[model samples]
Target chain A: MIGRLNHVAIAVPDLAAATATYRDTLGAKVSAPQDEPDHGVTVVFVELPNTKIELLHPLGEGSPIAAFLERNPAGGIHHLCYEVADILAARDQLEAEGARVLGDGEPKIGAHGKPVLFLHPKDFLGSLIELEQV
Target chain B: MIGRLNHVAIAVPDLAAATATYRDTLGAKVSAPQDEPDHGVTVVFVELPNTKIELLHPLGEGSPIAAFLERNPAGGIHHLCYEVADILAARDQLEAEGARVLGDGEPKIGAHGKPVLFLHPKDFLGSLIELEQV
Candidate 1:
Protein backbone atom coordinates (compact mmCIF):
# COMPACT_ATOMS: atom_id res chain seq x y z
CA MET A 1 0.00 0.00 0.00
CA ILE A 2 1.08 3.56 -0.67
CA GLY A 3 2.27 5.49 2.36
CA ARG A 4 3.02 9.04 1.32
CA LEU A 5 3.16 11.07 -1.85
CA ASN A 6 6.88 11.11 -2.55
CA HIS A 7 7.06 13.55 -5.45
CA VAL A 8 5.35 14.63 -8.60
CA ALA A 9 7.62 14.72 -11.65
CA ILE A 10 7.03 17.33 -14.32
CA ALA A 11 8.91 17.06 -17.57
CA VAL A 12 9.84 20.48 -18.83
CA PRO A 13 11.32 21.49 -22.16
CA ASP A 14 13.57 24.12 -20.63
CA LEU A 15 14.90 23.29 -17.18
CA ALA A 16 16.18 26.80 -16.42
CA ALA A 17 12.89 28.48 -17.29
CA ALA A 18 10.95 25.96 -15.24
CA THR A 19 13.27 26.50 -12.29
CA ALA A 20 12.96 30.28 -12.57
CA THR A 21 9.18 30.03 -12.81
CA TYR A 22 8.97 28.04 -9.62
CA ARG A 23 11.60 30.01 -7.75
CA ASP A 24 11.01 33.59 -8.84
CA THR A 25 7.45 33.60 -10.14
CA LEU A 26 5.90 31.10 -7.75
CA GLY A 27 8.19 31.90 -4.80
CA ALA A 28 9.18 28.35 -3.96
CA LYS A 29 12.56 27.06 -2.88
CA VAL A 30 14.12 25.12 -5.73
CA SER A 31 17.26 23.05 -5.78
CA ALA A 32 20.03 23.33 -8.35
CA PRO A 33 19.76 21.03 -11.30
CA GLN A 34 21.14 17.53 -10.69
CA ASP A 35 21.86 15.27 -13.58
CA GLU A 36 20.72 11.70 -13.21
CA PRO A 37 22.66 10.15 -16.07
CA ASP A 38 21.32 6.73 -15.29
CA HIS A 39 17.78 8.03 -15.46
CA GLY A 40 18.51 9.96 -18.64
CA VAL A 41 17.27 13.24 -17.20
CA THR A 42 18.32 16.29 -15.20
CA VAL A 43 16.11 17.13 -12.23
CA VAL A 44 15.42 20.12 -10.03
CA PHE A 45 13.64 19.64 -6.74
CA VAL A 46 10.97 22.17 -5.85
CA GLU A 47 10.61 21.93 -2.10
CA LEU A 48 7.16 22.37 -0.63
CA PRO A 49 5.97 22.05 2.93
CA ASN A 50 4.64 18.50 2.57
CA THR A 51 6.04 17.08 -0.67
CA LYS A 52 8.30 17.77 -3.64
CA ILE A 53 7.82 18.71 -7.26
CA GLU A 54 10.56 17.39 -9.54
CA LEU A 55 11.31 19.34 -12.70
CA LEU A 56 12.82 17.02 -15.28
CA HIS A 57 14.50 17.71 -18.60
CA PRO A 58 15.87 15.29 -21.11
CA LEU A 59 19.58 14.45 -20.89
CA GLY A 60 21.80 12.65 -23.40
CA GLU A 61 20.65 10.57 -26.33
CA GLY A 62 17.55 8.47 -25.95
CA SER A 63 16.53 10.23 -22.77
CA PRO A 64 13.36 8.78 -21.29
CA ILE A 65 11.68 12.17 -21.25
CA ALA A 66 12.57 13.08 -24.82
CA ALA A 67 9.56 11.31 -26.23
CA PHE A 68 7.31 12.86 -23.63
CA LEU A 69 8.61 16.31 -24.42
CA GLU A 70 8.08 15.67 -28.09
CA ARG A 71 4.43 14.88 -27.46
CA ASN A 72 4.04 17.86 -25.17
CA PRO A 73 6.47 20.45 -26.43
CA ALA A 74 5.72 22.74 -23.52
CA GLY A 75 6.33 19.81 -21.16
CA GLY A 76 3.82 18.27 -18.74
CA ILE A 77 3.32 16.26 -15.60
CA HIS A 78 5.20 13.01 -16.15
CA HIS A 79 4.63 10.77 -13.15
CA LEU A 80 3.70 10.53 -9.48
CA CYS A 81 5.86 8.70 -6.97
CA TYR A 82 4.44 7.22 -3.79
CA GLU A 83 6.35 5.79 -0.87
CA VAL A 84 5.89 2.15 0.02
CA ALA A 85 7.18 0.27 3.04
CA ASP A 86 8.20 -2.85 1.14
CA ILE A 87 8.47 -2.28 -2.57
CA LEU A 88 8.91 -5.95 -3.41
CA ALA A 89 5.79 -6.91 -1.53
CA ALA A 90 3.96 -4.02 -3.07
CA ARG A 91 5.08 -5.02 -6.53
CA ASP A 92 3.99 -8.61 -5.94
CA GLN A 93 0.59 -7.51 -4.70
CA LEU A 94 0.17 -5.17 -7.62
CA GLU A 95 1.21 -7.85 -10.06
CA ALA A 96 -1.21 -10.32 -8.54
CA GLU A 97 -3.95 -7.79 -8.92
CA GLY A 98 -3.25 -7.62 -12.69
CA ALA A 99 -1.31 -4.40 -12.69
CA ARG A 100 1.65 -4.29 -15.03
CA VAL A 101 4.99 -3.27 -13.61
CA LEU A 102 7.22 -1.54 -16.13
CA GLY A 103 10.80 -2.25 -17.22
CA ASP A 104 11.28 -5.99 -16.83
CA GLY A 105 9.21 -5.87 -13.65
CA GLU A 106 12.25 -5.22 -11.51
CA PRO A 107 12.96 -2.57 -8.92
CA LYS A 108 15.86 -0.36 -9.88
CA ILE A 109 17.81 2.15 -7.85
CA GLY A 110 15.94 5.39 -8.39
CA ALA A 111 17.12 9.00 -8.46
CA HIS A 112 17.12 9.13 -4.67
CA GLY A 113 19.22 5.94 -4.50
CA LYS A 114 16.20 3.96 -3.32
CA PRO A 115 14.62 0.92 -4.89
CA VAL A 116 11.80 1.99 -7.17
CA LEU A 117 9.51 0.53 -9.79
CA PHE A 118 7.22 2.13 -12.33
CA LEU A 119 3.71 0.97 -13.09
CA HIS A 120 2.14 1.00 -16.52
CA PRO A 121 0.30 4.21 -17.25
CA LYS A 122 -2.56 2.31 -18.84
CA ASP A 123 -3.20 0.45 -15.60
CA PHE A 124 -3.27 3.66 -13.59
CA LEU A 125 -5.86 5.81 -15.32
CA GLY A 126 -3.33 7.12 -17.88
CA SER A 127 -1.00 8.42 -15.23
CA LEU A 128 2.46 6.96 -14.78
CA ILE A 129 3.06 5.90 -11.16
CA GLU A 130 6.32 5.12 -9.40
CA LEU A 131 6.57 3.19 -6.15
CA GLU A 132 9.62 3.88 -4.03
CA GLN A 133 10.59 1.95 -0.92
CA VAL A 134 10.95 4.24 2.02
CA MET B 1 4.78 32.10 -1.63
CA ILE B 2 3.51 28.63 -2.32
CA GLY B 3 3.47 26.60 0.88
CA ARG B 4 1.96 23.17 0.75
CA LEU B 5 0.86 21.31 -2.35
CA ASN B 6 -2.91 21.53 -1.93
CA HIS B 7 -3.61 18.64 -4.29
CA VAL B 8 -2.93 17.15 -7.71
CA ALA B 9 -6.03 16.97 -9.87
CA ILE B 10 -6.36 14.11 -12.34
CA ALA B 11 -9.17 14.21 -14.84
CA VAL B 12 -10.47 10.72 -15.52
CA PRO B 13 -12.79 9.55 -18.26
CA ASP B 14 -14.41 6.96 -16.04
CA LEU B 15 -14.98 8.07 -12.46
CA ALA B 16 -15.96 4.64 -11.15
CA ALA B 17 -12.95 2.90 -12.64
CA ALA B 18 -10.60 5.60 -11.43
CA THR B 19 -12.04 5.44 -7.90
CA ALA B 20 -11.71 1.64 -7.88
CA THR B 21 -8.12 1.91 -9.09
CA TYR B 22 -7.18 4.20 -6.22
CA ARG B 23 -9.16 2.43 -3.50
CA ASP B 24 -8.84 -1.22 -4.49
CA THR B 25 -5.68 -1.39 -6.58
CA LEU B 26 -3.51 1.27 -4.98
CA GLY B 27 -5.06 0.82 -1.52
CA ALA B 28 -5.47 4.47 -0.74
CA LYS B 29 -8.29 6.01 1.30
CA VAL B 30 -10.64 7.56 -1.26
CA SER B 31 -13.59 9.78 -0.52
CA ALA B 32 -17.01 9.42 -2.00
CA PRO B 33 -17.84 11.20 -5.22
CA GLN B 34 -19.01 14.78 -4.72
CA ASP B 35 -20.74 16.62 -7.51
CA GLU B 36 -19.68 20.23 -7.95
CA PRO B 37 -22.18 21.72 -10.37
CA ASP B 38 -20.50 25.09 -10.23
CA HIS B 39 -17.10 23.64 -11.16
CA GLY B 40 -18.74 21.40 -13.73
CA VAL B 41 -16.97 18.32 -12.43
CA THR B 42 -17.58 15.48 -10.00
CA VAL B 43 -14.64 14.80 -7.74
CA VAL B 44 -13.26 12.01 -5.58
CA PHE B 45 -10.46 12.72 -3.16
CA VAL B 46 -7.75 10.11 -2.74
CA GLU B 47 -6.18 10.87 0.61
CA LEU B 48 -2.49 10.26 1.10
CA PRO B 49 -0.43 10.97 4.18
CA ASN B 50 0.79 14.40 3.12
CA THR B 51 -1.52 15.56 0.36
CA LYS B 52 -4.54 14.62 -1.71
CA ILE B 53 -5.13 13.46 -5.30
CA GLU B 54 -8.37 14.84 -6.69
CA LEU B 55 -9.99 12.64 -9.33
CA LEU B 56 -12.23 14.70 -11.59
CA HIS B 57 -14.83 13.62 -14.12
CA PRO B 58 -16.88 15.79 -16.39
CA LEU B 59 -20.29 16.81 -15.14
CA GLY B 60 -22.78 19.14 -16.94
CA GLU B 61 -22.69 20.43 -20.53
CA GLY B 62 -19.71 22.76 -20.40
CA SER B 63 -17.49 20.82 -18.01
CA PRO B 64 -13.92 22.13 -18.00
CA ILE B 65 -12.47 18.64 -18.12
CA ALA B 66 -14.49 17.53 -21.14
CA ALA B 67 -11.88 18.70 -23.65
CA PHE B 68 -9.08 17.31 -21.53
CA LEU B 69 -10.72 13.89 -21.55
CA GLU B 70 -11.28 14.17 -25.28
CA ARG B 71 -7.55 14.71 -25.79
CA ASN B 72 -6.61 12.03 -23.27
CA PRO B 73 -9.32 9.44 -23.23
CA ALA B 74 -7.53 7.34 -20.64
CA GLY B 75 -7.45 10.31 -18.25
CA GLY B 76 -4.43 12.32 -17.16
CA ILE B 77 -3.01 14.76 -14.67
CA HIS B 78 -4.97 17.95 -15.09
CA HIS B 79 -3.29 20.38 -12.73
CA LEU B 80 -1.38 20.96 -9.49
CA CYS B 81 -2.80 23.13 -6.71
CA TYR B 82 -0.45 24.89 -4.31
CA GLU B 83 -1.42 26.65 -1.11
CA VAL B 84 -0.55 30.30 -0.75
CA ALA B 85 -0.62 32.53 2.30
CA ASP B 86 -2.38 35.39 0.52
CA ILE B 87 -4.19 34.71 -2.71
CA LEU B 88 -4.32 38.31 -3.90
CA ALA B 89 -0.69 38.95 -3.18
CA ALA B 90 0.33 35.73 -4.87
CA ARG B 91 -1.71 36.67 -7.93
CA ASP B 92 -0.19 40.12 -8.06
CA GLN B 93 3.38 38.81 -7.71
CA LEU B 94 2.80 36.19 -10.40
CA GLU B 95 1.31 38.74 -12.76
CA ALA B 96 4.12 41.20 -12.08
CA GLU B 97 6.54 38.47 -13.19
CA GLY B 98 4.63 38.27 -16.54
CA ALA B 99 2.76 35.09 -15.68
CA ARG B 100 -0.81 35.07 -16.99
CA VAL B 101 -3.59 34.07 -14.64
CA LEU B 102 -6.51 32.20 -16.18
CA GLY B 103 -10.05 33.63 -16.43
CA ASP B 104 -10.55 37.20 -15.30
CA GLY B 105 -7.61 37.11 -12.90
CA GLU B 106 -10.00 37.15 -9.96
CA PRO B 107 -9.96 34.36 -7.41
CA LYS B 108 -12.99 32.11 -7.54
CA ILE B 109 -14.35 29.91 -4.77
CA GLY B 110 -12.69 26.58 -5.47
CA ALA B 111 -14.15 23.17 -4.78
CA HIS B 112 -12.78 23.35 -1.22
CA GLY B 113 -14.53 26.72 -0.75
CA LYS B 114 -11.24 28.60 -0.75
CA PRO B 115 -10.26 31.47 -3.04
CA VAL B 116 -8.38 29.83 -5.90
CA LEU B 117 -6.94 31.13 -9.15
CA PHE B 118 -5.53 29.20 -12.10
CA LEU B 119 -2.35 30.15 -13.88
CA HIS B 120 -2.05 29.78 -17.62
CA PRO B 121 -0.30 26.60 -18.68
CA LYS B 122 1.95 28.52 -21.08
CA ASP B 123 3.46 30.47 -18.20
CA PHE B 124 3.91 27.41 -16.00
CA LEU B 125 5.92 25.03 -18.18
CA GLY B 126 2.88 23.67 -19.97
CA SER B 127 1.11 22.59 -16.79
CA LEU B 128 -1.99 24.09 -15.24
CA ILE B 129 -1.32 25.45 -11.78
CA GLU B 130 -3.93 26.37 -9.15
CA LEU B 131 -3.14 28.65 -6.27
CA GLU B 132 -5.39 28.34 -3.22
CA GLN B 133 -5.43 30.69 -0.25
CA VAL B 134 -4.78 28.80 2.94
Candidate 2:
Protein backbone atom coordinates (compact mmCIF):
# COMPACT_ATOMS: atom_id res chain seq x y z
CA MET A 1 0.00 0.00 0.00
CA ILE A 2 1.09 3.57 -0.64
CA GLY A 3 1.94 5.83 2.29
CA ARG A 4 2.65 9.51 1.75
CA LEU A 5 2.78 11.16 -1.62
CA ASN A 6 6.55 11.58 -1.64
CA HIS A 7 7.16 13.83 -4.64
CA VAL A 8 5.98 14.60 -8.12
CA ALA A 9 8.73 14.64 -10.75
CA ILE A 10 8.63 16.91 -13.78
CA ALA A 11 10.90 16.04 -16.66
CA VAL A 12 12.38 19.14 -18.22
CA PRO A 13 14.71 19.67 -21.17
CA ASP A 14 16.69 22.41 -19.42
CA LEU A 15 17.50 22.15 -15.75
CA ALA A 16 18.54 25.77 -15.34
CA ALA A 17 15.34 27.14 -16.80
CA ALA A 18 13.20 24.80 -14.78
CA THR A 19 15.14 25.54 -11.59
CA ALA A 20 14.86 29.27 -12.20
CA THR A 21 11.11 29.02 -12.72
CA TYR A 22 10.62 27.32 -9.37
CA ARG A 23 13.11 29.48 -7.52
CA ASP A 24 13.13 33.00 -9.00
CA THR A 25 9.56 33.14 -10.21
CA LEU A 26 7.66 30.78 -7.96
CA GLY A 27 9.81 31.74 -4.95
CA ALA A 28 10.33 28.14 -3.90
CA LYS A 29 13.25 26.84 -1.88
CA VAL A 30 15.02 24.64 -4.37
CA SER A 31 17.97 22.39 -3.70
CA ALA A 32 21.16 22.46 -5.75
CA PRO A 33 21.10 20.20 -8.80
CA GLN A 34 22.51 16.73 -8.19
CA ASP A 35 23.36 14.29 -10.92
CA GLU A 36 22.46 10.65 -10.31
CA PRO A 37 24.66 8.71 -12.71
CA ASP A 38 22.86 5.48 -12.01
CA HIS A 39 19.49 7.01 -12.76
CA GLY A 40 21.05 8.91 -15.66
CA VAL A 41 19.35 12.17 -14.71
CA THR A 42 20.11 15.42 -12.97
CA VAL A 43 17.67 16.38 -10.23
CA VAL A 44 16.74 19.46 -8.24
CA PHE A 45 14.19 19.28 -5.49
CA VAL A 46 11.72 22.11 -5.03
CA GLU A 47 10.66 21.75 -1.45
CA LEU A 48 7.02 22.16 -0.54
CA PRO A 49 5.39 21.94 2.87
CA ASN A 50 4.01 18.41 2.63
CA THR A 51 5.76 17.22 -0.50
CA LYS A 52 8.38 18.09 -3.12
CA ILE A 53 8.54 18.80 -6.83
CA GLU A 54 11.49 17.11 -8.52
CA LEU A 55 12.82 18.77 -11.65
CA LEU A 56 14.63 16.21 -13.80
CA HIS A 57 16.91 16.57 -16.82
CA PRO A 58 18.78 14.08 -18.91
CA LEU A 59 22.28 13.37 -17.63
CA GLY A 60 23.46 11.32 -20.63
CA GLU A 61 22.43 10.09 -24.05
CA GLY A 62 20.66 7.05 -22.68
CA SER A 63 18.85 8.94 -19.92
CA PRO A 64 15.21 7.89 -19.74
CA ILE A 65 14.16 11.48 -19.36
CA ALA A 66 15.69 12.14 -22.78
CA ALA A 67 13.27 9.73 -24.41
CA PHE A 68 10.43 11.31 -22.47
CA LEU A 69 11.53 14.77 -23.56
CA GLU A 70 11.84 13.61 -27.18
CA ARG A 71 8.18 12.59 -27.14
CA ASN A 72 7.24 15.64 -25.06
CA PRO A 73 9.36 18.59 -26.13
CA ALA A 74 7.98 20.71 -23.32
CA GLY A 75 8.52 17.93 -20.78
CA GLY A 76 5.78 17.01 -18.32
CA ILE A 77 4.93 15.21 -15.11
CA HIS A 78 7.33 12.28 -15.41
CA HIS A 79 6.17 10.23 -12.45
CA LEU A 80 4.51 10.30 -9.05
CA CYS A 81 6.33 8.80 -6.06
CA TYR A 82 4.59 7.39 -3.04
CA GLU A 83 6.39 6.50 0.15
CA VAL A 84 5.90 3.04 1.54
CA ALA A 85 6.88 1.66 4.90
CA ASP A 86 8.06 -1.67 3.50
CA ILE A 87 8.84 -1.62 -0.20
CA LEU A 88 9.67 -5.31 -0.51
CA ALA A 89 6.38 -6.26 1.14
CA ALA A 90 4.57 -3.88 -1.17
CA ARG A 91 6.36 -5.33 -4.19
CA ASP A 92 5.60 -8.90 -3.24
CA GLN A 93 1.97 -8.06 -2.52
CA LEU A 94 1.63 -6.24 -5.80
CA GLU A 95 3.33 -9.01 -7.75
CA ALA A 96 1.02 -11.58 -6.26
CA GLU A 97 -1.89 -9.39 -7.28
CA GLY A 98 -0.56 -9.29 -10.86
CA ALA A 99 1.21 -5.95 -10.90
CA ARG A 100 4.31 -5.67 -13.08
CA VAL A 101 7.43 -4.18 -11.55
CA LEU A 102 9.95 -2.41 -13.72
CA GLY A 103 13.65 -3.13 -13.82
CA ASP A 104 14.60 -6.60 -12.46
CA GLY A 105 11.92 -6.81 -9.80
CA GLU A 106 14.50 -5.66 -7.26
CA PRO A 107 14.89 -2.46 -5.32
CA LYS A 108 17.46 0.07 -6.38
CA ILE A 109 19.03 2.91 -4.41
CA GLY A 110 17.20 6.11 -5.30
CA ALA A 111 17.89 9.84 -5.01
CA HIS A 112 17.17 9.89 -1.28
CA GLY A 113 19.54 6.93 -0.76
CA LYS A 114 16.56 4.71 -0.05
CA PRO A 115 15.23 1.58 -1.67
CA VAL A 116 12.97 2.36 -4.64
CA LEU A 117 11.20 0.58 -7.44
CA PHE A 118 9.11 1.66 -10.40
CA LEU A 119 5.85 0.06 -11.38
CA HIS A 120 5.02 -0.29 -15.04
CA PRO A 121 2.80 2.49 -16.33
CA LYS A 122 0.56 0.01 -18.13
CA ASP A 123 -0.22 -1.79 -14.89
CA PHE A 124 -0.96 1.44 -13.08
CA LEU A 125 -3.59 2.91 -15.33
CA GLY A 126 -0.88 4.41 -17.56
CA SER A 127 0.67 6.39 -14.75
CA LEU A 128 4.22 5.42 -13.85
CA ILE A 129 4.20 4.97 -10.09
CA GLU A 130 7.39 4.97 -8.06
CA LEU A 131 7.61 3.54 -4.56
CA GLU A 132 10.25 4.85 -2.21
CA GLN A 133 10.97 3.47 1.22
CA VAL A 134 11.43 6.20 3.74
CA MET B 1 3.30 29.57 -3.26
CA ILE B 2 2.19 25.97 -3.19
CA GLY B 3 1.10 24.26 0.02
CA ARG B 4 0.42 20.57 0.47
CA LEU B 5 -0.17 18.25 -2.44
CA ASN B 6 -3.96 17.98 -2.30
CA HIS B 7 -4.16 15.00 -4.60
CA VAL B 8 -2.76 13.30 -7.66
CA ALA B 9 -5.48 12.50 -10.16
CA ILE B 10 -5.47 9.56 -12.53
CA ALA B 11 -7.71 9.61 -15.57
CA VAL B 12 -9.22 6.21 -16.15
CA PRO B 13 -11.53 4.85 -18.85
CA ASP B 14 -13.51 2.63 -16.50
CA LEU B 15 -14.07 4.02 -13.02
CA ALA B 16 -15.29 0.74 -11.56
CA ALA B 17 -12.32 -1.24 -12.78
CA ALA B 18 -9.88 1.42 -11.63
CA THR B 19 -11.54 1.68 -8.24
CA ALA B 20 -11.35 -2.09 -7.87
CA THR B 21 -7.65 -2.08 -8.63
CA TYR B 22 -6.96 0.32 -5.79
CA ARG B 23 -9.48 -1.06 -3.34
CA ASP B 24 -9.60 -4.79 -3.91
CA THR B 25 -6.06 -5.31 -5.07
CA LEU B 26 -4.05 -2.54 -3.48
CA GLY B 27 -6.17 -2.50 -0.33
CA ALA B 28 -6.79 1.20 -0.40
CA LYS B 29 -9.71 3.05 1.07
CA VAL B 30 -11.67 4.43 -1.88
CA SER B 31 -14.59 6.79 -1.65
CA ALA B 32 -17.88 6.33 -3.42
CA PRO B 33 -17.86 7.79 -6.89
CA GLN B 34 -19.18 11.29 -7.38
CA ASP B 35 -20.04 13.06 -10.63
CA GLU B 36 -18.94 16.61 -11.29
CA PRO B 37 -21.05 17.73 -14.20
CA ASP B 38 -19.36 21.08 -14.52
CA HIS B 39 -16.02 19.38 -14.96
CA GLY B 40 -17.64 16.61 -16.99
CA VAL B 41 -15.95 13.94 -14.89
CA THR B 42 -16.67 11.39 -12.20
CA VAL B 43 -14.17 11.09 -9.38
CA VAL B 44 -13.33 8.80 -6.48
CA PHE B 45 -10.98 9.81 -3.71
CA VAL B 46 -8.48 7.28 -2.36
CA GLU B 47 -7.40 8.47 1.03
CA LEU B 48 -3.76 8.18 2.05
CA PRO B 49 -2.15 9.19 5.32
CA ASN B 50 -0.33 12.27 4.05
CA THR B 51 -2.38 12.97 0.94
CA LYS B 52 -5.09 11.63 -1.34
CA ILE B 53 -5.35 10.02 -4.77
CA GLU B 54 -8.20 11.15 -6.98
CA LEU B 55 -9.28 8.71 -9.67
CA LEU B 56 -11.10 10.43 -12.52
CA HIS B 57 -13.24 9.06 -15.30
CA PRO B 58 -15.00 10.99 -18.06
CA LEU B 59 -18.56 11.90 -17.30
CA GLY B 60 -19.57 13.34 -20.66
CA GLU B 61 -18.43 13.55 -24.26
CA GLY B 62 -16.36 16.70 -23.82
CA SER B 63 -14.58 15.64 -20.66
CA PRO B 64 -10.88 16.46 -20.79
CA ILE B 65 -10.02 13.13 -19.17
CA ALA B 66 -11.82 11.44 -22.07
CA ALA B 67 -9.40 12.93 -24.55
CA PHE B 68 -6.41 12.01 -22.36
CA LEU B 69 -7.61 8.41 -22.18
CA GLU B 70 -8.19 8.39 -25.93
CA ARG B 71 -4.54 9.17 -26.44
CA ASN B 72 -3.51 6.78 -23.65
CA PRO B 73 -5.77 3.75 -23.63
CA ALA B 74 -4.43 2.84 -20.23
CA GLY B 75 -5.23 5.59 -17.70
CA GLY B 76 -2.55 7.92 -16.33
CA ILE B 77 -1.86 10.67 -13.84
CA HIS B 78 -3.99 13.60 -14.94
CA HIS B 79 -2.84 16.57 -12.85
CA LEU B 80 -1.33 17.57 -9.55
CA CYS B 81 -3.32 19.77 -7.17
CA TYR B 82 -1.56 21.89 -4.59
CA GLU B 83 -3.29 23.58 -1.71
CA VAL B 84 -2.83 27.33 -1.40
CA ALA B 85 -3.68 29.61 1.46
CA ASP B 86 -4.92 32.37 -0.82
CA ILE B 87 -5.72 31.18 -4.33
CA LEU B 88 -6.60 34.59 -5.79
CA ALA B 89 -3.38 36.10 -4.52
CA ALA B 90 -1.46 33.10 -5.78
CA ARG B 91 -3.15 33.48 -9.17
CA ASP B 92 -2.19 37.13 -9.44
CA GLN B 93 1.39 36.40 -8.40
CA LEU B 94 1.72 33.59 -10.96
CA GLU B 95 0.17 35.77 -13.66
CA ALA B 96 2.55 38.63 -12.89
CA GLU B 97 5.37 36.11 -13.20
CA GLY B 98 4.04 35.18 -16.69
CA ALA B 99 2.36 31.89 -15.86
CA ARG B 100 -0.84 31.66 -17.91
CA VAL B 101 -3.84 30.57 -15.90
CA LEU B 102 -6.21 28.32 -17.80
CA GLY B 103 -9.99 28.84 -18.34
CA ASP B 104 -10.52 32.58 -18.34
CA GLY B 105 -8.22 33.11 -15.36
CA GLU B 106 -11.05 32.55 -12.91
CA PRO B 107 -11.15 30.08 -10.05
CA LYS B 108 -13.92 27.60 -10.55
CA ILE B 109 -15.59 25.46 -7.90
CA GLY B 110 -13.84 22.10 -7.89
CA ALA B 111 -14.82 18.63 -6.67
CA HIS B 112 -13.95 19.51 -3.05
CA GLY B 113 -16.31 22.51 -3.28
CA LYS B 114 -13.26 24.72 -3.08
CA PRO B 115 -12.08 27.37 -5.53
CA VAL B 116 -9.57 25.92 -7.97
CA LEU B 117 -7.68 27.15 -11.03
CA PHE B 118 -5.54 25.24 -13.52
CA LEU B 119 -2.30 26.51 -15.00
CA HIS B 120 -1.15 25.91 -18.55
CA PRO B 121 1.17 22.93 -18.86
CA LYS B 122 3.60 24.80 -21.08
CA ASP B 123 4.22 27.36 -18.37
CA PHE B 124 5.08 24.89 -15.59
CA LEU B 125 7.57 22.69 -17.41
CA GLY B 126 4.71 21.00 -19.25
CA SER B 127 3.08 19.76 -16.06
CA LEU B 128 -0.50 20.93 -15.67
CA ILE B 129 -0.56 22.51 -12.22
CA GLU B 130 -3.75 23.07 -10.23
CA LEU B 131 -4.09 25.39 -7.28
CA GLU B 132 -6.90 24.90 -4.78
CA GLN B 133 -7.88 27.15 -1.92
CA VAL B 134 -7.68 25.29 1.38
The CAPRI classification for model 1 reads as high
Q: What digit string (tens of lDDT, one per residue) describes model 1 on residues A34-132?
A: 999999999999999999999999999999999999999998999999999999999999999999999898899999999999999999999999999
lDDT values, one for every candidate: 0.95, 0.88
The numbered model that scores best in TM-score is: 1
Per-candidate TM equals 0.99, 0.95
- Fraction of the reference Cα-Cα interface contacts (below 8 Å) that each candidate reproduces: 0.89, 0.73
Task: Note the B-chain TM-score for every model.
Answer: 0.99, 0.95
Residues B85-110 of candidate 1 have per-residue lDDT tens digits of 99999999988999999999999999
Model 1: C-alpha RMSD to truth? 0.7
Any runs in candidate 2 off by more than 4 Å, and if so which? Answer: none
